[model samples]
Structures are given as structure tokens and as C-alpha cells.
Target: MSEPKSYIQVLSPELLGRVFDAYAHKPDEEKHLIGLETTLFSSCESGFYANPVILSHVSKNWRNISLDRPTLWSTMIMVRPIASHIPKVENWLERSKTAPLTLQIMQTIPDDDTPIEPLREERTAVNTILEMLLKHIERWEAITFFLCIGFLPAFAEFPQGKLDQLKSATLNLATWSTHPQVVDRVFRAIHAAPELEFVSWCASFFQTGLPDHVPWQQLKRIELDVNDISEEPSSVGYVLDILSKCPQLTSAKFILGFCKTTTPKALNTPLNLPNLRSLALDEASSPNIAYVLQNLTLPSLHTLNLSLFSDEERSSANLFKAVGSLVGRSKSTLKYLGLDIDDEQLLKLLPFAKDVEVLRVGGAKTKKFTSLLTRNANNKISLEVLPKLEYLHLTYAQDAMRPHRISASTAALNRMVVFRTSQPPATPGLKKLKFISVGTAASSFQTAHITLILGTYSHLNLKSVRFEGN
Candidate 1:
């Protein structure tokens, strides 16, 4: 009898080719594929079967089809590249032909016990890899680098206008010392790229602040994360200055370290962002966060996220008031709001954003907020707070300082969900709640209770209900 045919041998070439293409572009949470040399490494946790390079070795027919598809080889992720992989990199680039390339060059972060110095051979390998990539600069569509500051000089050699196809770039430069001159030169090279629109710049603090030569007018999205370890933290005024230059930005995020105290003269006038739609500010003191909210006028803002790590209660009170005033002054119809604040502060800020459709909060105590959402003694939803809220996400904040603090009880959550979902369709200005996600301690909420809630609400046509345990 003839041997039985395997799955690969029985499938048609066209169907197999489509499968190969889909696997090549599938998103991986870990992005564990080391590079083009997939056979030399293995990720025991995620498995190597997801790598597209593995398909070529399955059979002769599969190899022929893989070689014929150029786009399948366009994306290359190099993690701690070495000299031995040079030939594989060349072969991969050659196979991509003229297709646009998406590259991610990363290095393993060293722990405290590990040496910070790069091995002599590793430096040679990195330099050679970058040199090869520069030869095809015109085909770069998106590139991300998580490397040391020493590599910034290599990018200064990029010819102007050679990055016409580049639309996105992420520079995560890290080192113990600052290099303002090198950083400035790199920014100058980036400014010459006319097609660049999205950028994420993360680095340690620089005394000179952000470069002024960037193509800010052409950018639509930007994220700046500056970790300040110096005696004087960067000022919010400097960040506002950068935003003033970007008139075309629709989304912006600023994650600064400790912020310097703001004086009345810091912001002489209110800055207007007529086109911005989304903004997020994180890790600043309460006063600094309030300072930012007080000086900005976002007429088109729809989504906002604010997080503070300050311990001053008075400043937090001021921050809440500032938020309410900003929303009221802009008269913008906010659709989404996220806050890492307490229940009282959240309640005070929600009234100004009554049109918000989604609300996310992180706090140790949310009983009061959930009660406000539940039907009152008259069996009616509150018209004054979040009348149009459709989705609610609550994250339990486990602070070591307040170990006895309790989160929203399971009973409170169930009642709130039932009340919001049971609202009559004829109710004016009130929308039925469709989704709820709760993240709390495992002991507080059990899987059986969640199952019971799902069984009870299944008839209400709710979209989804999720529970995550810590």
C-alpha cells in the first residue's frame, strides 16, 4: 500500500500560499521572531511555528511559493543582532526586492548585575547591520530602534529626502549620560523627511530640551516620554512650547518625570489646540497636571487621560477642579474619559463631561461611583452625571499604604449593571449600558458570581461582561 499523504502534500499551492501570507503578517504580542535566521533560535513559550521562514522548509512546492512572494519578507525584526547573521540579513533583504520595509532593531536591557558595556564584537555587528539598512533607506515605511545613544551618530549620515517613503519612526535612545549635540544632529536628519508623520521619542532628560528642527507641522501623532533624573525636573512650559509648533497634530501624549513648579509667568496666555482630538498626561505632580489643564483650550478634544502620583491632598483637589473647568470652558463634547483618581474626584469631574460614552477609572474605593450609576429610590438614572455612558471599566488600585481600603463590592457592581441595562428605551438622553469590565482581587469576586451575572443579563442583549482577577 502507498504511504498516506500528509496535510502539506494534499493542500493546493494557491491555498497554501494564502495561508503562508496570513501567518507572515499575523500580529504577535511578544514579537519573538528574532530575525530572518529563524532556524537558529526558538521561543519555547510562543513556539516557532508562527515564523514564516519555517514554511519554506516544509516541502519543495512550499519553498518555491515562498520565494515567489516578495512582501512576505519585507518585515525584519533584529533583536541583539550578531556578526554571524550577516548572510541571512542580506538574503532576506534581497528577497524583499522593492517592497517597503518595516524594521525593529532592539537590544536586551541589562539588569543591575549585568555589565552595561557592549561586547567588542556586538558593536561591529550593529554597525554593519545599520550600514546595510541605510543602502535601502528610500524603501523604509516604518522603523523602530531601541538602542543605546551611541548609535545616534549613524543616523546623522542619512541623506535628506532619501526617506520619502518613511511615515513612522520610534527612537528609544537610552544611556547614562546625555548627548545633546548628537541628539540634535539626529533630529536635523529626521526634519528633512517630508513624508514622516508619526513619531515616538523616548530618552533620558536633556538639558537643552526638545529640538526645534523637527517637522512638527506635518506630524499628526506624537508621544514624548522623558525620564528626568536630574536635580531640576523639566518644566511643563517647555512641553507646551513643543505643542504650539504642531498645528496638524490630532493625538498627543506626554509622559514626563517629576515636573518643576510652575509660576504664574510660565504660561502668559492660554494655548489653543483647535485640531487635537486625544490627549494623555502621566507621571506629573498634581500641581503640574493642573497647570497643564488650566492653560490649554482644546476645542475639538474627545478623549483625555490623566494620572498623577503626588501625595498632596490639597493639590489633588485643585487638579479635579481644573479638569472640570477645562471641560466646561472648551465646551467640547467628550466621548471618552480615563482617570487614575479617587471616587470623590471622579464624581466631581464627571458632571462636566455628561456626554462621555466610555469611562475608565482606577481607584481603591469605587462604591460611591457605582452607587451613583445604580438606580435611585425612584428607579431612575441620574441625568446630571454621564447620561450617555455606554461602557464602564473599573480597575482596583492596590496601594500598599492603604491595605485595608476596599474596592467596589460584587453586589454593588451587579446592581449597577442591572439598573443601567434595565433602563427604559424611551428614557430621554440616557443610553443602555452595553459593556462592563472589572479587574479586582480574586477573593473579592468569584468566577461563579460572574457566571451568574452573565446568565441573568444574557436576556438584556448586553454586548460583553468581563472580569479579571489579580
Candidate 2:
């Protein structure tokens, strides 16, 4: 008699194919099964899924299934491309057949005090990989580059309009190296792509300012970050000038460096963005973000996030004032608001965003804010303060050496929730609070405190109430 068939050998090809397909696309947490180890090309990053190369080595059946699935090899993320990666990259490209590719090439900057210098071998490896990828440029769907400035020349040779299938591109320089001409060529090549809609560029804005040849009219989303280590800061006028050209933008984020320049004179008419729905502005330690807010009219905006690192009272007050004026001028119905400001300023700004359904406050003293939400002796919540709010998240600043301070007492938080939910069902324009999260320093809130709060409110049917200590 023939030897007993093994369990794997008995499965039909159809079933094996389905199993391989599911295994290849499982979530990162679930991909740590017995046989899935780091192959030659697997990324150890948190979000990346398991590599298909390991499956191909499991058995002849598995190998055939994996090799036939082009999509299984389409996404390639190389943390730091090296000479050893060329063969595996070539293999992946061959297996991927004609499927579109999503590529992420990153080289993290060292955190130590040592000066940065790109190794010659690393540059050569990167150029080899680029040459291989450019051969299949028409199959590129999305690409991300977080590399040293030396690699910019490798991209200078990219042919214009060859990225016919590209939709998104992220180019971030991890060093202070500046090569404007190479940067311009890279931008021009990307701008010529017919289908590109999103672009994120992080670099030293003072040296390599916004490229003059971006496909601004076709871009739907854009994120610009000014390098933090640069000595010179970007001005508000320069940023506003860039925005004026992108009339089709629906989402925009600017992480501006320190800005010492005075606010440019207001546009004869505020720059109108009727289609923009989300806008975020952050400054390292400057109040100049107010100038950006002061100069724009976003009639379609529903989400706004403002973060200013300065702790000066004057800066906080001015920033909040500009926010309120912009809200009133736009008359846009805001559905989400995020602020990194003092509690007092937050109180002043909430009245302008009465339609806000989600509120996120970070690095704020929350005692007063929670009190404002609590019911008065008459058991009535103020109609002016986030009456439509459904979700609230508060994160407090913490120092490592000092003891944790409770920003909002458990009583205040519980009372705020109870009052917000106790409103009459027939109350017009009020939404029942559904979720609340309080993230604080370690030991600020105990596990029992969160359990008690949840147990007491079980009847209210709150979706989630979480207290996280860090």
C-alpha cells in the first residue's frame, strides 16, 4: 500500500489557493504564525504585512499558488536598500507580473550626535533598485522615498510622464543636504505624471522652497513639512502664495518651521477655497500659523486642527482670536475640531464651533473645560458649548521626573458625561455623548477608577469610556 497522504498533500488546489490568498493579506498581528519568519525582504516595521517569499518556500503547492498571484508581490517596502536586496527585488518584480506596485524606500536618520554621511555602497544599491523600478515605471501606483539627499540624483533621470499609473508620491529628505536643481528635476518628473493626485514633501523649505512646477491644479491632497533643523524659518507669505495656486485642494496640512516674519497684509479678498474640507496648521514655536488661518476662506471645511508650540499667553490669545474670526467669516458648519491651546482659549473658541461633533484637546488644563460641560444646579448643560458633541478626547502634558497631576478629576469627568447624556430625548440639536477618552501621565488614573466609571454608566449605554495612563 502507498504511504498515507499527508494533510497538506491531500488538499485540493482550489482550497490551497484560497488559503494562501488569505494568509498573504492577513493583518500584521495575525501574520506571526509558525512558518512566517523574516525572509530576505520582510520589513520589521509595525504596519507592513508578512512577506510572500516565505510562503513560496513552504511547499511546491504553496509556491505555485504564490507565484501565480501577482498582487501578493506588488507592494515592496525597503527600510534601507543595500546590495543584497537587488536579487530579491528583481525576483519580486518578476513575480508581480503586470500588477501595479506600491513602493516605500526609507532610511531613518540616526538619533545620536554623529554627523550623517551616506555610504557609497548604499547609494549604488539605491541607484540599481531605481534603475530596475524605472524599467517598470508604468506599473507604479504609489511611491514613497525617505532617503538622504544623495539619492536625489538617482531620481533625476526619471523620464517625465512615464508614471502613468501613479496616484500618490511622498518625498522626504532625512538630512539637511540641499540640492535645488536635483530637487527641481524630481518634482518636474512627478508633476508630469497624469494620474498623480496626492504629494507629501518634507524638506528644508528655506533652501528648497515649494517647487514652481507642481501639478497643483490636479492635486487633491498635499502635506508640506519644513525641516526642523534649518536655521532660517519659512514665512507666512511664502506658504500663502503656494496655497493660492492649488485651487482644487480638498485637504492640506502645513507643519511650518519657526516663523519670525510679520503677517502679510490681508488679501484684498481672502483666498477662497470652496472645495477644501480639512485643514491642519502647525508651527514649531511660532504664532504665525494665525496668519495662514487669517488669510483663507474655506466654505466647505468641516475639520480643523491647530497646534502652536508657543506657551506665551499673547500668542495663544491671538491664535484663538484669529480662529474665531475665520470660523465666523466662513460660516462653515464645523463637525470636528482639534486644539493644542490653553483651556481658557479653548473655551473662547468652542462658541464659534457649536456644530462640532468631535472634539480633541491636547496639552491643556482640562479642569475648567470639564466644569463648563457639567450640569449646573438646574441640571442644564450650556447650549453654547459643544451641544452636538458625540466624541471627546483629552490628552494632558506630562513630565517624566515629576509626579502626575490630575488635570480633570474623576468626579468632574463623570458629571460631564452624565449631564451630557441626561438631556431629554426630544431636545433639539443635541447629540448623546457616545465616546470619551482621557489619556494622562502614569499613575494619574487607576484601572479601578475606569472600571467604576464604566460600571456606573452601564445604563446610559455609552459606546466606550476609556482612561489610559502612560
lDDT for model 2, please. Answer: 0.71
Off by more than 4 A, model 1? 1-50, 54-69, 82-88, 115-124, 149-160, 176-182, 204-207, 226-231, 266-269, 310-314, 376-384, 396-406, 439-460, 467-470
- What is the lDDT of every predicted structure here? 0.68, 0.71
TM-score for all models, in order of appearance: 0.78, 0.78
- Tens-place lDDT per residue, model 2, 1-470, is 89999887888877776666566555554433222123224522334456788888988778888789887888887765678889988998999899999887765444455245535566677778888888898999898877763544556665776788989998765353556556666667778888999987766334546656778889989887654424576566766877888898899887765665466677787888989999987643435667778888988999998766545422544666787778788888889998866556777777667788998776554678778776443544475577789998776435332222336767777788888776666566677788987665333444554665566676776899776653
Worst 10 residues of 1 by lDDT: 39-48
> How many clashes (backbone atoms < 3 Å, residues ≥3 apart in a chain or on different chains) does model 2 have?
0
Clashing pairs in 1: none
- How does residue 264 of candidate 2 score in lDDT? 61
The list of candidate 2 runs beyond 4 A from truth reads 1-49, 52-69, 81-87, 111-125, 152-156, 174-180, 204-208, 226-231, 284-287, 313-321, 375-384, 396-406, 440-460, 466-470
Error of 2 at 43 (Å): 8.4
lDDT (tens digit, per residue) of candidate 1 on 1-470: 99999897788877777778777766443444432333222111122224457878987888898888877787776666677756666887898899998877765555556455543455567668778888998898888876652554455455666888888888666462456555555556666678888877666335445565678889989888645323466677767877998998899888754666663454667788888999998766667677788888898999998766533422544666887777877878789998765556667777667788998776544678778778543554365567788998776434542122335666787777887776565566677789887654322443554555456666665798866553
Clash number for each model: 0, 0
